[model samples]
Target: MTGACRRARELVSDACARWHLPELVAPASVVLTELVGNVVRHAGTPMQVTLTLRRPYLQVAVTDGSRRDIRPVPAPDVRAEGGRGLLLVRELARRWGIAPLGDGKVVWALLPAA
Candidate 1:
């Protein structure tokens, strides 16, 4: 899982650099990690991560083989390591959402490119 997260971060960072949107690297990396990590830890199924340039936003999408709906919950315990991924996504992303995709779903975040 750690390796997958690291690779996702590197991919997002490299894409941001290539697109000349260096400012997006940090947020995009964070968002990707959180989204992908969620799939790894919870879904435990096949997943796909994608980064795309969409006008003024850089979009990150994680598609997983699960139909369960995901929602951001407030962490009841400050010391808990889990349950904070979506919260971080909400904070860092310009906007985020989950959409049903056949038998699974795609969780996505958009960060401002400008």
Candidate 2:
């Protein structure tokens, strides 16, 4: 999981640099880490992370090995130190959702390219 997060950051950083869009790296990196970490924790397997460039958006997808219902844990007490990952993604991403895959699912997010 940690390695996945690290690799995700590396890939995002490379994309940002190659695209000459350095400003998008931080939030994208955090979201990627959270999404990939969820895959490792809940899906019980390493996941695949991919990034795609589009006219006005960047698409990030993380495919996990479980089709378990993955939903955001809403309204945790502020003092609690975890479970806010998906909530953060919901708030930060322009758009996001989960799609069923064979024996698994892929969670995806779209962020503004502008």
Give Cα-based local distance difference scores for all models. Answer: 0.89, 0.86
lDDT for each residue of candidate 2 in 43-70, tens digit (9 for 90 to 100) = 8876788998895988889988897988
List clashing residue pairs in candidate 2.
none
Off by over 4 Å in 2: none
**CA displacement after TM-score superposition, residue 110 of candidate 2 (Å):** 0.6
* Global Cα lDDT for candidate 2: 0.86
Model 1, range 1-114, lDDT digits (tens) per residue?
Answer: 999899999999899889998888888888999998999988999989999999888889999999988865576478885777898899999899999989899998989888
Give the distance in Å from residue 90's predicted Cα in candidate 2 to where it truly belongs: 1.1
TM-score of each: 0.93, 0.93
RMSD of 2: 1.2
Clashes of each: 0, 0
